[model samples]
Target chain A: MVVASRKAAYHHKDGEMTETLVKKNMSASRTSAVPNYRGQQVELGRETVGNVRCANPFMVAENVNVFYGDNHAIKDVTLEIGKKEVIALIGPSGCGKSTFLRCLNRMNDSIESARVTGNISLDGGDIYDKTLDPVVLRARVGMVFQKPNPFPKSIYDNVAYGPRIHGLAGDRAELDDIVHRSLERAGLLKEVKDRLDDPGTSLSGGQQQRLCIARTIAVNPEVILMDEPCSALDPIATARIEDLMDELCEDYAIVIVTHSMQQAARVSRRVAYFHLGYLVEVDDTDKVFTNPHHKLTEDYITGRIG
Target chain B: MPNQMTSRARVEAGLSRRKRKEKIFRASGLLATAIGILFLGIFFSTLVAKGASAFVQTYLLLDVELTAETIAPGGELDLEYADFDGLVRTALRNNFPELSGRNDRRELNRLLSVGAGFQVRDLVVANPDLIGTTQEIWVPAASNVDMLMKGNIDATVDESLRNLSDRQIRWIDTLDQAGRVDLRLNKALFTNGDSREPELAGIRGAMMGSFFMLVVTIALAFPVGVAAAIYLEEFAPKNRWSDLVEVNINNLAAVPSIVFGLLGLAVFINWMGLPRSAPLVGGLVLALLTLPVIIIASRAAIKAVPPSIREAALGLGASKMQVVFHHVMPLAMPGMLTGAIIGMSRALGESAPLLMIGMIAFIVDVPGGFTDPATALPVQIYLWADSPERAFAERTSAAIIVLLAFLLLMNLAAVILRRRMERRW
Candidate 1:
């Protein structure tokens, strides 16, 4: 009820101006929106707006900073991911949304120059503790990259790779069961049921992305982090992956980093907006879209700033 | 409108010059390629022209009376300690009865190869029952006579200038006219080992030596080089130590191969007490010479594998070792094999390193094992080329042809294996 009232008040105060600005920006040139918004003298917020807490927080990151050599790639940011909810991180390029997502699985450890300092915990256990192996952490917190990088192996092997490495299955039959279930959950089993022996690279772009997701989920990770998973896919494939993400939220806490506002709005329950490596707003997806309290989030949502 | 028209005209004016430049560049490239091919054609034609005659050998058919009295010298048929040379001399004397003087008989005997006695002994040993009867045997002629029969020696030259005297030439002509002289396929060249007699010399020993040395080279260099490449390319931390190692590896490839021979001479021969002139020592030296090449090639191949594949495997929770062995190694195998084959071919053709280890010695027996004293194909060519005999020149060219053929075959195998492996991806 409070979100509805706030959204209505926002519509009444700036509805006409925002509509005109959007229309003019779409019809005229892109440069005009910046000047019109600058005339408003909008103040960019330093701290996060809206509620950052969830009813059931399971994975939490606090004061995370990442540096790649001398470059500060990701600044201090804090957020919480609920146990069974989809949180989409939306920002412009180089805004640290992807970097933050990589931090969850410690994928940045592969970069020789990258150093991460933060308190990130899964189930109240520190993920970056020396005793906890990155390999073990990655098995529990899986990732999908921007590009569909399937191993140069058969589709069955691609899905079975994680389970075999983590020893999730005891025998061939159990491994086959895991592979089939993962492929079925990713919605690719029916399409590739007959040709499991075919190379994963033989699949189309969307199918390859789905294969990658199946590969990630084969280990039964508790959280699946997707770094712009649907960016490389067409609209139809993107919609399928978005729908898959929606269904996947019921079982796994999914943290997706995306550039498309519509994708974040369509698939996520809560949305976090990052601006220049800072978490400017974290709120319900509907609230962030209609009534973002931070001016930078609003400017980005209305296409005034990328 | 006028400015647009001028811009269009200017671009049109520049287009012809650009096209002319492109044409000139293409023509120069084609010209360079033509020059290379022309040089290769000349080289191969000269090699073939010089080496083709060595395939056929001239022989003299002699009527030998293998009497028990002469061959056995007893009532019992004794094959060993036989006077086979006397039988050849007696056959030659019967053919030219007019040459009764010591000088004439000696000149007559020079028409036959020194290997003729060995040939007669082999025949008599194979057929001991024919000891009491006369047999017609075709034995190899002397190198000079063979050269004259092959038209390599100018018979019109003064007898003093040529190795063959006028009497020997006249006897050859008489024998040729009587249908007793023939040109047969040179089976002895492939069957026998090295000898002072050019007509009796063969490259079988060198071929076997090369085979054993290459076996040792590949067995030692390939795995070690590829392992080093994998460790450096995949697992090693990027630090000053690794950088220094990388620089040293690249420098090792540029080191003269003979220096590796010296190292092997000191370390493997003198220090380890391995016998000199053995294929094992030669192979070890060549392995050192080839390791840098294989490592460089393997590193390049491993580097060529897209980082995405590594990332994909790593993201799947595969350990670094698993990621490399399962994905990176298989994908880089074709290129690694190509590099190894190229290195092996280079080792096959290398003679400098083997020379320092005493593989340049004159080996008369086919190498039965790696430890046997032997000479590689290139070393054999080097040895034959250094000889003063006119026939050794043709043998040198023939050995070169054999070496080139082996190199071609190895390269062809590399191409075929690469194609087969690449199709899996």
Candidate 2:
């Protein structure tokens, strides 16, 4: 009966199941005669709910785990990021969401004691292959930090930093064009075009964050990873960045780690919820919010547990 | 309410006691500062009072007949073998025609400096026509006469106690009355080299030695120190070996500089077979002493650069080398330069290491190259201070003043460079 009920809820398709309905379903499963759901015995944190695979995946991780000197930072996890899609990884603090995000671009290699096991691939290429340089990989998968860190250089140089380093531009005019287009796409050209010579640090916090975004996009990476890019911004700036993610997703896959559920709901097509280093559930944004299949995902979304 | 009132009164009492304690602490700090300033003021005042006399030297004008027979005896205009001292003696005897006895004539001739002959030679060499005519020449007086004229010697004291005898004082008075005695700027103090006669001794030789050593020291230490700091801070693995190196570097910074002097003596002088008393050897020794300081300071400067900058560069696909050279290095350069300047200044004031490398030897000629034999300013000052001559005491203070000035200028440059670099950022 519980399996049938969960199957019914999974195929509900309404996309607007009320919080009471999710709670009623959870309570009914607890009291039901059948002790199984989805043809398996139910467990809160052991198994992930919903689908982990995507229709057209480009970046894939399989049973990936991360350890920092024997401290399990990220547990056995699997997820796929597709081309031209926005995926949000959301969890409470210390849940390893950011760690998992770093794993995609092999950024975890910088940490001395961090050890990653299992497989992660981008476009069927093993990124951890000894022959593949991390420098080249980072150019393909760029990251925006939680804080805006513009170089101690002019706005133009900050935007030109990636292109110059990667030899992406062949000449001065080409570099200038790249910088101009990046700033324009980041929605900062009108504000900073007249003062490209000004130090990037001289900008307002929101503008500096936008300048960092411009810097990231100047390299034209295949995927852009943003780790709580809006956490340091005010609500208006956060809205601006959320709108930018919407527009940016059309050209490249974007993975965002955020603490704001509303942000995940607004920006991402799919939402992955992590709890205690475990990815509890990943599903379509509406399903994860309105009709979560896992008890922990439902409880977390309903403010019952973090 | 009664309990609350007591508690408030107790709090007020404790606050008054804390304020009293703070006042006492502040007064103590002020007192310490005042004491330090007082000592510094006394030191500078004494230095100026003693060293000011060295800037001006006493000269005696003499009408000397530079006979061609005495200067170019063979009519070949020979300058090196000229009897310049005989010409000076004849001029002195002409001035005092009354002194006929051999002892009286000898005492009168002693009034002129031994360098007076060299001065006359230089004048004649510059103007060959002066060799045949009698001309009025202003010659530096002997150190004793200079001391008496500068009031360093007490004429009121008995002849036995004074540096200048009664007869010499009388002669100087007669010259003063005739308007032949004058005080002029001591150009010799800057132009000439060390001499047995105090009036001929100058600091140019030691100054050149110090300059050459400092040049070599900074050239060797700055690049090596900065490179080591970069590697240890940016690329070195955090393991047992790196940890040991870090500890050893910290220890090396605290090592007494004299130990480095000993090491330089054993290595550069004994094993390497480099010439002793050469500025090159002194510079090598000082570089050893300064390297630890520069490395430690450079590491601190490199560490002070925010990690976010490194990450920003790294995130942009910059290689580790590119990140360090293009980003981290530029951001850390101002700090590194400041550290290097400070290290160079410390090396400048360092005399202990140079002393062990035989730089304490009394060198007479200014160093023209790194390998030439030389002495440093501090060693010259030390030698002068140990001299019995009253004039050397003044020169010692003057050398100290020059050293202090250079130190002040270097520190000022460091401050200005730091301010400018920080503003650029």
| Candidate that scores best on DockQ | 2
List, residue by residue over A43-93, the lDDT tens digit for candidate 2.
544356788899999999887767665455666688988888999998778
Candidate 1, residues A57-94: lDDT per residue as tens digits?
A: 98999877676654456656788999989999998777
Give the candidate number with the greatest lDDT: 1
lDDT of 1 at A74: 61
What is the iRMSD of the candidate numbered 2?
1.8
TM-scores computed on chain B for all candidates: 0.97, 0.95
Candidate 2 chain A, which ten residues in sequence have the lowest lDDT sum?
Answer: A33-42
Total residue pair clashes for candidate 2? 0
For residue B252, model 1's alpha carbon misses the true position, in angstroms, by 1.0
For residues B236-265, what per-residue lDDT tens digits would candidate 2 score against the true structure? 999999999999988988888888989999
Q: Give the TM-score of candidate 2.
A: 0.91
In CAPRI terms, where does candidate 2 land?
Answer: acceptable
In model 1, residue pairs whose N, Cα or C atoms come closer than 3 Å (at least 3 residues apart or on different chains), thus clashing, are: none
